[model samples]
Target chain A: MSEKILIKGNEAIAEAAIAAGCRHFFGYPITPQSELAAYLARRMPKVGGVYLQAESEVAAINMVYGAAAAGVRCMTSSSSPGISLKSEGLSYLAGCDLPAVLINVQRGGPGLGGIQPSQADYFQATRGGGHGDYHIIVLAPGGVQEMYSYTRDAFDLADKHRMTVMVLTDGILGQMMEATATENGEQTADNRQEKPWAVGGVRGERARNIVNSLYLKPSELEATNLSRYEKYKQVEETEQKYDSYLLDDAEIVVAAYGASSRIAKNAIDEARSKGVKAGLLRPITLWPFPKKAFAAAAKKARAFVSVEMSMGQMIEDIELSIRCSRPVTLCNRVGGMVPDPAMICEAILNANKEATA
Target chain B: METRILIAGFGGQGILFMGKYLAYIGMSQDRQVSWLPSYGPEMRGGTAQCGVILSDTAIGSPLVEEPDILAAMNLPSFHAFEKSVKPGGTLYYDSAFVAAPGTRSDITYIAVSATQTAESNNLKGLANMVMAGALLKSLPGADGGVIETAMKKTVPERKREMFDANMKAVTLGRAL
Candidate 1:
């Protein structure tokens, strides 16, 4: 246990990456998430790690792929437009079965959008941003502490699943500051699993390991994709992480993630005070989607409200998760705008009215 | 108990720093605190603001929409956030810089010439601290001694020489 320090969420993620033994960081500076790369640039060298500001987002993610293939924990971070450029590298990393961490401190976007907090990158992140039959483990951190702990655990998750682990956050969570204890007693490099398949020098000990994503043969590619899907299936079953608040007997369930979840929680509290049975189900892992929790809550929930910073992107997931058993409504603000608690509370109240009507 | 504070001013007016200092003081007292800045392409002289929340329970949203305490350091900030203060909340403004009168009677309006006090006390560029001192005095359960301890941690190590001047500015504001 270490003393709590008031730190920015971006800096907390950077510090946690170092604590998790991530030695390589390759990133291009982008708004909202620039502090993360800047922090690493200052601290990486002091901790005997490598921090390289690549010429472009493309180069940065490729650099991450290079480091991860060499059996080192490495990462890259960017905003919405920057993440689009790195999508190619993300697919390559997935195809190669490389372990790495990536961060998307998202801003509004289709291209070159405004630099404010947004959850518009939900589809780009959760549905495999690039071309391939693949999925990255997406961890959406709601607060500064989760920003720290999740980044640390992201390294382990990447290694365990042999895939990219993304800490999908928004500009608000990245820029906000909160009291967090950076040092947890359990984080050390010694706890990391050995990467025997890493393409480091074999020293003439057994066969050399090869790292490549190329499989031209149709049969081989199909087999590889099948095996990867099996891994993803297992992850969906075992790694679904979420936080439930007053959900046991609630008739209105609000499904949210990342920064929007914080707003949803506040709205739920207000709704409860108004005699509405509104609860919050915040998904910590966006890719896994916490389907079980949603399905269970749907049994008692009459309606589900998805509060998001995007134009109802996560609403599809809520509908799919519950198998459309309950009516799902969308309450959203987009283009760098965030919804206040009142707006979400109004939506919850509307859902309550609709359910009874 | 919870206090949602919104501090707004020009970028170079130490708006973000004042919010951070308050957040540090809250943390020192073992209160749950969160500070969020309104970040964008705005540079120095452009509008810069931050929200600080100090609470006893878990904080849901860090953004302060309807602030319980609104501290406006400049005219633009005062005009922008004056109406957003909760009813029965407190609005602290630097009357020297913001030259605005309160229109609402529901909220308490306290005017302090923090800018003039800082300039006279040779604490230029530290009017934010002065306003913060006034806020500390008004905040419930905030220990007066905690400000100095938090200042020790809040002020960067490279700028240790400015500690006394900052304290002096805060004291002048408190006395006023």
Candidate 2:
């Protein structure tokens, strides 16, 4: 057994990115996510990597764009407000087919919300926060260990699909500390500078690559979008990940993701102790939504409760996933408040009562 | 066994550090542990608190809504969190500043003059360590020696003197 070390979620994510060969990090500091930038700032120098604190979120995301265009495994992180500023850059990265990782340690709000943990950005994350019809792969982790593992996978998935990937988290998970094993983490950075599409001189062997997002011609733009859709479909087929607990004979299924899923586990355990056949279906990949898992569980589940730290945001996707075969209920706490386990247990019991009635 | 703890105090009273130390000890034991702090603008001078959960199995939630242990450092903290302790749980508080800790027969209550002990030992900032010691003494599974070792690693080299004082405070509080 490898020795486990205690690490904060933000720091773990940064280290995982470093272990995944992501060297160049361009991000502005924001509450909840500032620790990530700080960790990279301290570790990047020792590892002979670049860690630039851009002047603004706008500039930081654009810097990531420039680095990604050169085919470097670069990333940027921010909270809700800062992520809003980077929407344009994210769209541009998607359009250009540049593989870049973005992290949103979410805080509350549509405007400048408070600096507390929140999952209110669920719709924004899955439904495309940026303009245009582009989709970014979003992975939500329930704990600190997954925070590290999923970040490493986010880099791999982004590069594999040549798309933008996001690790959607909340302020609480970003600040929480937990024990995580570093067994699977790479020991050295692999910044290989060999991409056929990268905009760098070919050393007289081939034509210079021109990486761009602009398509003035309508037909060319349509073709580029169609090709991007094909890649998105491939990702949907292969990249969906989820975890289920006590779901085999579950009469009530509690659907949640990220930190909310952590709470739902406790509720499920409590409900089972009281003879309630409750289960938890946690969507690890938020973008793909794990529709099949829900569809399978819905066959036995009499009702579904979509638990979140937001006011019914991800519940929409949950309903769509199950095709509303069973009644879908929402149990949530918004504005940076976390859901209580007892409240969720109560929701499960209520759903069971409704099923019997 | 799972031990869920909630430590509450003023912003400068090292509540977050207290929880972190407990989590560090749990990690040293190779146990599944989590430490979550209450953050934001309220942390400047208002109340501060953190939750720490240690379990032999994988932890479900990092957030502790109903804690098995409550360590309060001040009057406001004591008043704010006394009722949140689970039935048959433990509540340890510093009696040096808090006069009334309220009555609750369902839970075990321990009032240690942690601040007085630290001040008497010329360790004004070691009250949190004293509480840790008291907590170690009251809990069934935790080891004081493991916590001491964890404390040594948590304290930086520049704060070597502070570590000695903290250890002294812990020893003093353990007797209570």
Candidate 3:
């Protein structure tokens, strides 16, 4: 086993991507996530990888699209507003059925919001940020360790699914430092899979592969969308990931993800000490949404509380996950503010009260 | 045992570095530790602060809202965070900067002349280390050897020459 080292979350993500055999990185500098690009800039060249600081988020994502079409592991990262700038490239990548990793170390948003930690971009990440009948695999990392592990695994998930896989994290997780064990030394590229459909010269072995998103015919477009939806359906059935704590007999279930889930775990412990039967269901995969876990919790839970660093954006998904069988409450902080454990404990107490009432 | 520490000072005072050192100490002891800094515009010129949590079990909520230990390196930081320490908690401040100690009677306040000590020892820009030494003296399971080890690991290789001066500053604070 590798020895644990003290590292920041953003650096962890960058190193993990390198360990996962990603050789191409294109990104624009943005607050709360710039460290990721900076780390890559310093380290990527050492590994014979390309780390290009694009002119803008739009250009960075398109660069990712280009590299991904060549069957190379590639990625781009940005904050909330920068992510909005890359939405167009996201759609193009999805429409063309390319594999890529996108990292959104989120800050508060609508426009140019504050650069503090926030999960406000939940909707944008899980709802197919760009316009289309499509979905991207979104992994919400709760801490620095997940920031590393999820980023390493995301490359494989993207390649296997032939779609974009997003590591949707917040500023707190991005900036925080913790002790974690990562794969040491330079990584070998022995694990990369061959992509038969990539846009490279066939050398007369087969027809040339064309990577394009434009379907001139309506029927072809519909068929393409249908096939993509079928892939998404398979992902939904098997890719849901979550973590549960003290949940078997919980009456009040707290549903949270990313940074909010860490705070919620503390609140659950506080509530438990105060005689409130609270539990936590932390979603690791935001796109798949962990509906099965929530549905199981709803069987024994009387109420659900969504703790978020947004204005209750994930609450809608929780409601739909359980089919509204249980009343779900929103315990949130927004505009770059994070909810403390005391606030979440109070919310849990209130939910417990309503559950028993 | 779980201890939440909040360290605050002006930007470039090594406030975040002090917190990270404490986290490293925790890690050396095989404890779960987390260090989170206050980033963005406020860190440019305004007061800079960071939260460090060291616990025996899994740590939740890396944000230290009500710190069990508060280290204020400047007057503004002391004034800003004096009231946020939990009752019966500990507060350490640089007496050379903060003219007066906190008015709170519930918590113990340790006034260390961290800045003066650092300046006198020719270890300028290391008052944060002095304060860290003072904090280590109070923290359970953190001894001089542990701190020395942590310091050796925390300080970058390029700055190895300053190890002696940093140790001198830490020893002075521990003496206080």
Superposed by TM-score, candidate 1 places the C-alpha of residue A137 at a distance from the truth, in angstroms, of: 0.5
Task: Write candidate 3's Cα lDDT for B30-104 as tens digits.
Answer: 899999999878777788999999999999889998999999998888998999999999999999888885798
Model 1 alpha-carbon drift over 4 Å, by segment: A184-187, B156-159
Q: Which lDDT tens digits does candidate 2 get at residues A1-357? A: 145677889998998898888889997999989999999998888767899989999999999999999888999999999999999999999889999999999998869988888999888889778888889999999888889989988888888888889999999889999887664334654644456788765798988888888899999999999999998898888888999888898999999998888889999999999999999999999998898888888888899999988889888888888887899899998888888899999999999899989
lDDT of 1 at A89: 97
Per-model TM-score on C-alpha atoms:
0.97, 0.96, 0.98
Instruction: Tally clashes: model 1.
Output: 0
lDDT leaderboard ranking? 3, 1, 2
Per-residue lDDT tens digits for candidate 3, residues A334-353, read 99988999999999999988
Candidate 1 lDDT, A104-147, residue by residue in tens: 99998878999999999999999989998999999999899999
Which is better, 1 or 3, measured by TM-score? 3
- Each candidate's number of clashing pairs is 0, 0, 0
Tens digit of per-residue lDDT, candidate 1, span B27-124: 87889999999888664359998999999999999989899999998888899899999999999999987665789999999998899888887888
Instruction: List each model's interface RMSD.
Output: 0.6, 0.9, 0.5
Looking at candidate 2, what TM-score does chain B attain?
A: 0.92
* Model number 2 iRMSD: 0.9
TM-score of chain B of 3: 0.95
Candidate 2: which pairs clash? none
Query: Which residue window of length 10 is worst by lDDT in model 1 chain A?
Result: A183-192
